[model samples]
Target: MPDLAYYASLPRTRGAAAALLLDDLGRVLLVKPTYKQGWFLPGGVIEAGESPLTACVRECQEELGLTPRLTGLVCVDWAPPRDGVDAVNVFVFGGSITAAEIAAVRLPPEELSDHVMAAPEKVPELAPAHIARRMGPSLRGLAEGRALYLEDGRETPFG
Candidate 1:
């Protein structure tokens, strides 16, 4: 368990986001937070009374300048150890948009610097630490499909 005292003292924030995974064929969507200046999946804090899915769609429009139909919830992560903040819950949804659409996107400096599709192996360089960690197993699961989910986010040791 984390330090509840510190967590309770800090303000809680709710956010929604989507992860657009594309191949190195020059495609994918990611955002750079102005406060942290790190490459992260596109999405932002949910508005005071917005649904998570709605917020995710809105964030994709605002950050990537494209409308994405979220296909599935890939991962829900709880990030820790950022200043006094208790946790940052990240909701990752799988979706796709045309490369032509991404080319037309104009990102504001506050949200994203640029969006590009890169090779899956290169993701570690672009993804934030917490995000990268969460993605590691998820990607494997994506490749393995239902067989992977049978364990529910666990890793089996290799001989």
Candidate 2:
């Protein structure tokens, strides 16, 4: 068995969780982070001792100011390391937002800059490449009541 120091020295991948929220018009909700260049799903990095689902719910409440009841897993994407950044495993959950909930959204200016309800087709234009690539499969998975496993945002034969 590995010693505690050995285990602690092992490489660890980052984990993040996001919500795939939709409105009555079937438009997806996207948020622009003040720290990033492109739009992204409503979520953030998973904290210590936090499950993916719990992180998703907590992030949604913190970012959108609404505690939505997330339904099911939509996608689990493994983004390979790039530009010296550690690899990240992203878990996405599906949920719907009512008009009232949408109206109640309040972004913390220090974190998020803006939010938009964009048609599914427009997601690719607004989000980062990885996020855009993951959107279609995620949506399909949601509609089929199944979850997708993706590598670098593309579905693979094996997880």
Candidate 3:
């Protein structure tokens, strides 16, 4: 009755943005959420009216207490629907942290209970499979200076 057809025609999807924050030592930043099980990147769900890149920076500040100087796109993943949930579009951006930025870390206690700076090789063991797959390639792409289009975590020709 109230434009139900219009709503039905719209794509049902969610979006999130994450920062691939690397230190001078080439370690990646990981945050432990009190509400979640495994370690994840310094990022969260993108809010409506917010651009993906901007959401990445915002989440970093909210979670880590430092305004990361985000640079290039790392990888964009199109994750299919799971458990009847809408599909998700995840964007990861590469950002390097200065010593000053590291010094400014003041994690929000209520959200994050712990943090880790892990070597590249250890990211897979640190995060869940979906994230692990993405992080490895993201770190590589950051170093190789290229961005990738991915489905879930694997780089595929089709998105």
Candidate 4:
């Protein structure tokens, strides 16, 4: 077994979960957070001992005030450390919401300012570069009906 010091020396990565929710017209649902500069998906950091999917569902409920029936894992992206932040492993899940659900969305004024259903191409304009980069692989995963693994939001050739 490894020593405690050896274990402590290993690099630590944070886990975050986000859902790629789409409307009937296939527009992506994006949220504008009051606390952040750019728009983001309806999800947040994983809590202690919580699974990524659990965090995704919980965030959706908290952010949008409704429980979403997530289709499945779309892509898992390993984001490199940047902007003085630690590395993060982001799990993106895919789901579709109805018009009723859209009507039911209630954003907490302190956490979020607004929400919009944007075409996929507009994602780059709304979100940060890192987040925008993930959309391609995530959408491809949803379309292909398979999960994908990515690094810095780009799919790798090797398994």
Which candidate has the highest TM-score of all?
2
Residues 1-159 of candidate 4 have per-residue lDDT tens digits of 769998989976799999999899989999999987998889999998899999999999999999988899999999999989888899999999998899889998999999999999999999999899999889889887778999998889841
> What is the per-residue lDDT of model 2 for residues 1-159, given as tens digits with 9 covering 90 to 100?
659998899987799999999888989999999987999999989999999999999999999998976789988999998779789999999989988888899999999999999999999999989899999999998788889999999989953
Score candidate 2 by TM-score against the native: 0.94
Taking all chains together, each candidate's TM-score versus the true structure is 0.71, 0.94, 0.88, 0.92
Model 3's lDDT to the true fold? Answer: 0.86
Instruction: Kindly report which residue pairs in candidate 2 clash with one another.
Output: none
As a TM-score, model 4 comes out at: 0.92
RMSD of each: 6.5, 1.6, 2.8, 1.8
Ranked candidates (lDDT, high to low): 2, 4, 3, 1
What value of lDDT does candidate 4 attain over all alpha carbons?
0.91
Q: On residues 44-65, what C-alpha lDDT tens digit does candidate 1 reach at each position?
A: 7778788777878888778777
Clashes of each: 1, 0, 0, 0
The 10-residue segment with the lowest total lDDT in model 2: 150-159
Give the lowest summed-lDDT range of ten residues in model 1: 145-154
Worst 10 residues of 4 by lDDT: 150-159
